[model samples]
Target chain A: MIQRRPDWLAGYGLLSPAIIIMAVMMVTPLLAMVALSFWTQQGFELDRSFTLANYFALVEPSSEPTYWMGIPFPLTYPVPAILLIKSLAMSLAITLAVIALAYPMAYFLAFHVRGQKALWLVLLTIPFWTSYLLRVFAWKIMLGFNGAINSGLKSLGILTEPLSFLLYNPLAVMITLIHAWVAFAVLPIFVSLDKIDRSYLEAATDLGDSRLRRFLQVTLPLSAPGTIGAALLVFIPTVGDYVTPTLVGGPSGTMIGNLIQELFLKQNNAPLGAAVSITMMVTIAAIVTLFLWLIGFRRLRSRAR
Target chain B: MQRIKFIDRMASGRIDRRTMLRQAGAFGVGLLVLPRLPQAAEVLTCLEWAGYDSPDYFKSYTAKHGGAPNFSIFSGEEDALAKVLAGFKADVMHPCNYSVNRFVNAKVAAEIDTTKLSNWKDVFPALQMASGVVMDGKVVMAPADWGNSSIAYRTDLVDPEYAKNESWSIFYDDKYAGKVCMLDNEIAITIGMMVGGEKYETAAVATGEKLAAAAKEWGTKVVKNSRFLWNDPSELQQALASGEVVAAYAWNDVYRNLKRENIPVAYAKPKEGYFTWFCGLTMLNTGKADPALAYDFIDAWLSPDTGKQLIEGSGYGHANMKSFEISDKQAITDMGITDPAEHMKQGTLLIQVSDAVQTEWNKAWGDLKALKQ
Candidate 1:
C-alpha cells in the first residue's frame, strides 16, 4: 500500500492566507476592542479589572423628556442612542436614494449601450477618481452660504441674500452621501442586471406580457440580489460614517461615529467608546438580520445557488 | 540630491565605473550576508506643530549642531499627547499651557533643567510662571509662544450694535443665525461659561454647580446659530472672507490674515476676556538624545531672533519679551502683541482641570454637541 497525501491539506493550505490575514487584520482588532470595553480607564492607566460601569453609564437615565417613539433609551446618556437612530435613519435614506438613482444608470449601461459598455462604466466612475474629502469639499463650496449657487443666482437677480437653508443641514448631508456612495451601489446592481438571461425576458414577452410587466416580473426579480447586496454594502458603512456628517451636518450632522471618536480621542474614555461601538454593531446586526429574514433570505440565496 | 552626490563623487574621482560596480556588488553582497539592523535613532526629534519646523526657529541650534533636528508635525496637542503616550519618541514636544500638566501627569514629559537654557530668564517671567508650565518647583515646559482665542467678525457684515459690545453673546445672537463659525474645543466651553454669566474657573467647570443650565442654553443657542464648527484656522478665515459668516471664534492669526487681505475684520476684545494659550516645549523622558543638545535647541527657540520671526510671520506672541522691541512694529500691532507683557499679566489663562471635571465637561459637551444634531 502506498501512502497518499491528504487532500484536506491542499484545501487548508489554500485557505490559510485568507485566514491569517483575517486573524491579524480583523479578528485581532475586534478582540482588542471587546477586551477594552470591559476595562476601566483612570487617567492614563487602564485597570484590567472587569467592570460593567461603562456599559451602565451608556444607559443611565436622566430627567429629560422621554424620546417620542419610546425607544427605551436612557435620557441622560441619550447622545449615543439618538445618534445611532439618526445615523441609521440617514443611512437608510441614503441607501434608498442611492439605489433609486443608480438603478436607472445601471440598467441603461446593462441593456441600452450597444457598444463601449466599459467606456460608459469608466465614464460613470470618473467622478469617483478624486479623493472623497475633495468631493465633499466641492459640495461644501457649492452649498455654502456665499457659494457658487448663491453667487450665480444672486448675479441673475434671483435673490438679495444667499440662502441660509442650503448648507450645514441634513439635506446637504444626505445629498453629499448619496453622491459619494452611488458609485459603490452602481457596480453590483449593474453586474446583476447584465447577468440576467435574455431568454427569461423573451419568455415573459412570448407570454404576452408588456415591457413594463416583463420587467416587473422577470428582470426585477433576477436583479434583486445585486440591488440588495449594494444596499447592504452602502447602508452598513454609511451608518458609521462621520466625515460627511461632520463636514455638512452642522449642528445636526454629528453621528454615532463622531461620538465614538469623541470617546476615544477627546473624552479619553476608550472603554465607553468600545462599548458604544459594540452596542452599535449589535443594533445594526439585528436590524440587518431582521430585514433579511423578512425578505426571505434563505429562498433568495438558494435561488442564486 | 542623490544624483548630484553621485555626480560629484564621480567628478571627484572618488567613484568611476569600475569602482561604482565594485561598490554596488559589495553592497548587495553585504545586504544578503549581514543581519538586518535598525537604523540609528535620530539625535533630536522635536514633535512640533506644522510650520514650527521652519529652520529659522532653530537656526542657532542648527549652526552649532551642523543640521536641524528631526521634526514631526501634529495639528492638535491632544493628538500629540496621544502619540507621545503611545510611545512616539521625541526629545521635545510642544503642548499648550492647559495640557502641560496632562503630559506631566502621564509621565511622558520630563522636567527641564532651566539652568541649561540661557534664554529661559528672558522669557516673560509671567509666562514662565504660568500655572501648568511650572509644577512643584520643577520646570516641565519652557514657555514659547501664545495665541488668543476670540471672535473675528466682519465689520461690514455684522451689526454695529453687537460688535460694539465686548460680549461672547455675539455667538448666540439670533440675528446671525446660520452665519457664524465656532471653534470646537474646550475654548468653546469657556465661551459657554461666559454666556452662562459665570466666571470661568476650574471649580465651576469641574463641578457643573452653576454652569449646567447655562451650558445647555449656550450649547443650544450657539449650535443653533453657528453654521459650522471650525477645526482649522484657514477654514474660519475663508468663511469670513467669503461673507459666509458674520463672525467666528478665531485665533489671532485669522485676524491678522484677514487684515492683510484688506477684509473689514475686527478681533473682539470680549468683556469675558480672550482665551489666551501658552504652548511650549517639554523634554521627553524617553529621549536618548544629549540633554545639552535638547537644551541648546530650546534656548534657540526662546531666542529673541526666533521670537521676532515668530511674531512677524505667524502673529503669535513669542515668550521672549525683547522680541517685541525688535519685531516689525506694524506686524506686532497686527498680532495684538505690542503690549504682550502687560497683556500676559492680565490675561485670562486656561487651566488643567481635574479628571473628574474633564469627564463632566466632556459629557456635557458630548450631550450638547449631539443634542441639536
Candidate 2:
C-alpha cells in the first residue's frame, strides 16, 4: 500500500512556478535594489562599501528645502521628498477623479442595461486598444497650442492666438490620467456592483427603506471593496509614473519619478537613485497602509460578510 | 539628435527574423566570392543611432564585406553606453563627443586603428583630435556626422532686436516666458552657464563647485521662465513649427526640417557662439565580429559619397572634409557645419567634463531640472 503523499508537497508543487517567478522577477531585484542602496557610485563603478551616506543624504540639509504650493519641508536633500509629495498629491487627485467618473458608467452597465452587456464592456475597452502612449499623444494634440481645441475655437471665432495654457501643466496631466485610468477603475467596480444580491435590496425595501436609503445602506456598502481596490489599482502605478508627467507635466509638473530617472540614467548615480526609489516605495506603502487603517478594512470586509 | 526618433520607430519595428535572414543571405552570398578571406564572411554588427542605419551610409562596407553590417539601433547615447557596458555584443557603436569618454574609461571601447581607415586623413583635424577622440594618443572614436546645439527660433515671431544678436539669454526673457522651450539635459546646464557669462570652454566652469551655485541659479532662471524642457529634438521642432514656442534649444536638423516645411524658422547664431556636437563610430572591445571588417564599416561611413547623402538626405554635417565639396554649399553654410574647432572659439565644443566635475554638473543639472524655484 502506498503511503499518502505529504500534504505540503502537492501544495508547493502547484505553487512552484509562481513562487519561482516571484523569487526571480520581484524578490531578487528588490533584494539587489536594497543592497545597491547602501553602496556609493564613483563614476560608473559602484563602490561596494557599506555606508549610510545614501540614506543620510536624503535629509542632509545641503541646500534649501523646497516649498511646493505652500507645503513646507524644513529639512531634506533638495530633491526626493518634495517630488514624493507632489506625485502622491497628483495620483490621489487622479484616483478620485477616476472613481467619480467610472462609478456611474459601471453602475449604469451593471443595473440599467437590458442586454448586450458584452458590447458595452467592449466599448469601455476602446481607449485601451491603442496604447498608453498613443492615448497621451492624442491628448497632447488636442490640447496643444494649435491643437484641436484651440483650432476649433478659432474656427468658430471664439477667440484668437489659441489657449497656450491648455497643455503642459498639472491640469493637463490630471485630465489625461483620469481618461487613461478610468477604464481600469470601471471594470472592477462593475463586477462588484453586478455581484450585489438583489434580494438584499428587496429585503431592505420590505423593511421600509427608500430606494436612495437602500442604495446607501446596502448597495454602497457592498461595493466598498471593489471601489477601494479600483482606487488602489489606479493609485499605485500612477504614483510612480514618469512618462505621463514628463510628457505633459511641464516644469511645474516635475515629480519624484522623473527625479529618480535623472539619478539612475543621467547622473549615473545608481546608489542615490536606488535610495530615492526605496524612499518613494516606503512612503507609498505607508500612505496605503494608513489609508486602509483609516477605512477600517477589517470591519468593512466583515460587514460585507 | 532630432533626426533620431523617426529611425528609432523603424528599427524597433523591423529588427525581426526576416531582416536577419535577409542579412544572413547576403553574407552567405559574400562568403563564396571571397572564400579565402574568412573575416569578410563573418558578419559585423553596428550599434548606430536610429536614423543612421540607412544603407547609403554603409554602401562601401557592404561592397567589400559581401554584406552590410547588421545594425542594432539605439535612441540615446546614454542608452548606447549602458548597452555596451552590459556586454550587448555590438561590434561598433556611434557615440557623441560628450559621451565617448565614458566608453574609453569603461574599457568597452577600443582604440580604433585609424590607419586602416583610408578616409581618416580627410576627416577634420579638429574633430580627428577632438578631446574624446584622441585620449593619450589613441583614436578612440572614428569621427562621422556632427551638428550644432543652438537656439532654433521662429524668425517671424521673435523681436528683431533679439534675433539680430541671438543670445542664450532669450530663454530667460520675460517676453517669451512660457513660450520658449529649453533642452532638458546637461546641455541645458552648459547653456545656463553661458547665459550667466561664464565660458564653459574654460576650466573655471568644470573643475569644481566654483560655479555650481551659479549654474544652479542660471538653471532656475532658464527653467523657471521657459515653458518646458524638451527631451526629443522633434518635440522642440514641433513647438517651433506651430509657433507655440518662439524659440527652443534645438539641433541644426530641427532648423532645416522646419525651414523645409516653410515654417519660417531660423538657426540662431548667438553672440556667445554655437555649441558644436559631433558623433562618430567607436569599435566595441567585444570582438564579436572580425576586426578588419569593422574598420571597413567605419571607412564606408567616412566616404564622401555616404557623407553627401548624410548631408543631403538626413540633413546633418558629415565629418569628411571632402563631403562639403559635393553637397549644396548654401545648405552647408545655412546649417553652420563649418570646422568644429573654429566654432569652438566662438562657443564651446561640448566635450565630456572630468568625472569629478561631471558629478558636480550632474548635481547642478539635477537641481536645475528637478527644482521648482
Fnat per model, in the order shown: 0.45, 0.38
Write candidate 2's Cα lDDT for B121-203 as tens digits.
99988888877788889988988988777888887889888777889888777788888898766566667667777776763
For candidate 1, give the lDDT: 0.81
Q: In model 2, what is the error at residue A250, expressed in angstroms?
A: 3.1
Model 1 over residues B245-328: C-alpha lDDT tens digits?
Answer: 888988777888898899999988888777777888899886778878789999999999999988887788898989888999
List clashing residue pairs in candidate 2.
Answer: none
Per DockQ, the best of the predicted structures is 2
The number of the candidate with the highest TM-score is: 1
**Candidate 2 TM-score to native:** 0.86
DockQ for each numbered candidate: 0.22, 0.25
Which window of 10 residues has the lowest lDDT sum in candidate 2 chain A?
A1-10
Question: Residue B303, candidate 1: how far off, in angstroms?
Answer: 2.6
| Worst 10 contiguous positions by lDDT, candidate 1 chain B | B10-19
- Candidate 2 segments exceeding 4 Å error: A297-305, B1-56, B61-83, B86-90, B203-209, B286-293, B313-316, B329-347
